[model samples]
Target: MIFAYNKAHVGDVLMILVKNDNGADVTSTRCGNVTKIALKETNEVVAWNIFQASEMLGEISGVGQVVLSDEQIALLNEELAKEGFREVITQEKNSKFVIGFVKELTPHPDSDHLNIAQVEVDNGEMLQIVAGAPNIEQGQLVVVAKVGAMMPNGLVIWDGELRGVKSSGMMCSPRELQLENAPDVRGILVLEEGSATIGEAFSPEKHWHG
Candidate 1:
């Protein structure tokens, strides 16, 4: 999740995007302090905007470095109160990223160095993706930039076609994924299995998979 606010530009609400891509046509439901955003057809809770973030008790996991503004937290609380959800915001934050396991790898049909990979994000879901990095290996713990993720390069993850094949998110390389000081090389990043938990914020456990 990302938070942005402009104090000097205008007195507007801070924006937190649960889903990276929100279409223009959105349906909103206000339940006390929580506001639910959904598509008309699916009614899936694609995004949530709470009036107060602190008033929450126990849903969040992990320890994120984020410090939500009082206004933003209050907004989330207000929305939550409206929703009638139990007042439960957890002190822990969920993982937004997880180490993906590459189950299969294939050469990209249209690209010289790119390869198509079927990566499992520990969520039990497999995604077909294209990557240019070379050292990607099957059964390895690779970093997964799942769908709806926003790259440090400002690239938005979404469904798209690559060389006649439909690609879902991306398998990250330290450089292409835009991590700090990622090696500027031609290999994909392989996460040490012990480095990351199975799920939480960036992890599939915390993120919506279905």
Candidate 2:
């Protein structure tokens, strides 16, 4: 469940998302006044009071209209973590992607163009990733979308297999990272030597911040 501010409310108000469990709104009991919102072909309920009428998105767990502070969001994540539900942050304050060093590279057995790379991300762990770009080479510094990262274009990184190789994450290109002034070139984006640390977050927004 996630919390958000209801835009319709003129005053401060907080809304909590209660995921649909077993095709029923799980949090309807907490919100006394039940507002049953149709989730397309699903039986889910958005139980709340004084919310502006709107459509329901089936994929999202829940979004409340109540805005929360950074401290409040942290507290909520901690509380929710105790319940075995993944922590959900309502705001995007930090970049989930990071810079990485390509520690090793090897040719894929089945594909001549595909390469299996060992990339060391921050946290002292090496991630096995399958890369196809011809420019990628060992010892190069590149951007890595760590598992669970959400790319700017809405692609979520997850564990998967490419051909026959098990890949834990992705080596990103400039367009994939959605950087401003991104070069119109092919292959992955390679950072300059000493430009960034192996595990530093890729935060292009920092360049524009005072």
Candidate 3:
């Protein structure tokens, strides 16, 4: 497995999908059967596109189960190899998140339930992020968004999605990703594990353990 950045354009999420093509009737279908996933990079495969694979092939045969296809795997490898990225064999990236620390968290002057925080991400890059969580506090090791982050729920973190407002990225909590044990509330989360130093990484790997 790989930690592909989840992207949505039109209507799809991208991942460094690992599947075996057990040779089914990948052919014989017209369109929308197989989907096209572009392996892209901005230094790495930072963004990708998804579409019906059948459409990309435009009348072909011998396409089989993407999860069990040697040919498909080879094709994917070939693409990445061309770009110098090795094949990923573990699911670590899938369940982990690298985050920055929040040096300061201040209440938003505009709203009561809202708060503005000064977060230090990437060791040096600091940002003023507006948050709305009760438990959030100063000097807390919180999750930092390094620009391009996609919530598991398919909400793109680009400029805020609030009322006529723009947000840079998100300071994620467990529930946003729908962790099984995530507290049911709208609030920021404090990491109990991992270092939240700027540019560092953390993940909800523990969330699925129980």
Candidate 4:
């Protein structure tokens, strides 16, 4: 789940992103000050727009990617109920950016440059990623941006396929992470051995600088 609020630019509204519609057509339904956006065909809710949000949830501070507390989530549910909407929002507590260990790498059968990687991100949680970084190698410690990560450029990572291969996450480059003094070149950022614990959240402030 992602929440965003910018009173000055977007008015006193709260934007809640529940899921991506994958460019599918959508329909919007409004009840009171709340608007629910859903897929037109399946009616699966994808997002919500709450007008006058500050009046109910108090003033939210931030222009993008605002973090809400558990209390705030409950309040949002209450508001949804009041508006006769059955959908409920939940808080996502896990970090989407973390360190990963590449356990295996193989050439993609359908792609010339892309390589399929079996990466161990969390304890016993392996993800198949398609990386094109020429410098990528097995046994490397690298940054992994899992599905649902919101990049610095406002791009939301989602489960995707590459060249007929299923890829669950991304091997991030310094440029993709918007790191300070990122190299003007191609290749994923490789972390030094013992630099960080596998599966731990990656903090650029502590790990990288110009």
Per-model TM-score on C-alpha atoms: 0.55, 0.60, 0.52, 0.93
**lDDT (Cα, tens digit) per residue for candidate 3, span 58-130:** 3223211112244544454454455454543233332224565778766665677877777776647777777
Question: Which 10 consecutive residues of model 4 have the lowest summed lDDT?
Answer: 59-68
TM-score, cand. 1: 0.55
Candidate 3 residue 201 C-alpha distance from true site, Å: 2.4
Top-TM-score structure, candidate number:
4
Note the residue pairs that clash in candidate 2. 4-65, 4-66, 5-65, 5-66, 5-67, 6-65, 6-66, 14-66, 15-66
- CA lDDT of 31 in candidate 2? 24
- The reply for model 3, stretches above 4 Å from the true place, is 1-96, 161-166, 193-197, 206-210
Local distance difference test values of all predictions, in order: 0.59, 0.63, 0.49, 0.89
Model 4, runs deviating above 4 Å: none
**Looking at candidate 4, what is the lDDT of residue 197?**
90
Please, what are the lDDT tens digits per residue for candidate 2 over residues 138-181?
99988888765656654556678889799988998877877777
Better of 1 and 4 by lDDT: 4
| RMSD, one per candidate, in order | 7.8, 8.8, 11.2, 1.6
Instruction: Encode model 1's per-residue lDDT on 48-107: one tens digit a residue.
Output: 654444345323322222445455455565556656754423222333345677789888
Displacement of residue 199 (Cα, Å) in model 4 is 0.9
Residue 4 in candidate 2, Cα distance off native in Å: 11
Q: List the candidate numbers ranked by TM-score, top first.
A: 4, 2, 1, 3
- For model 4 the TM-score comes to 0.93
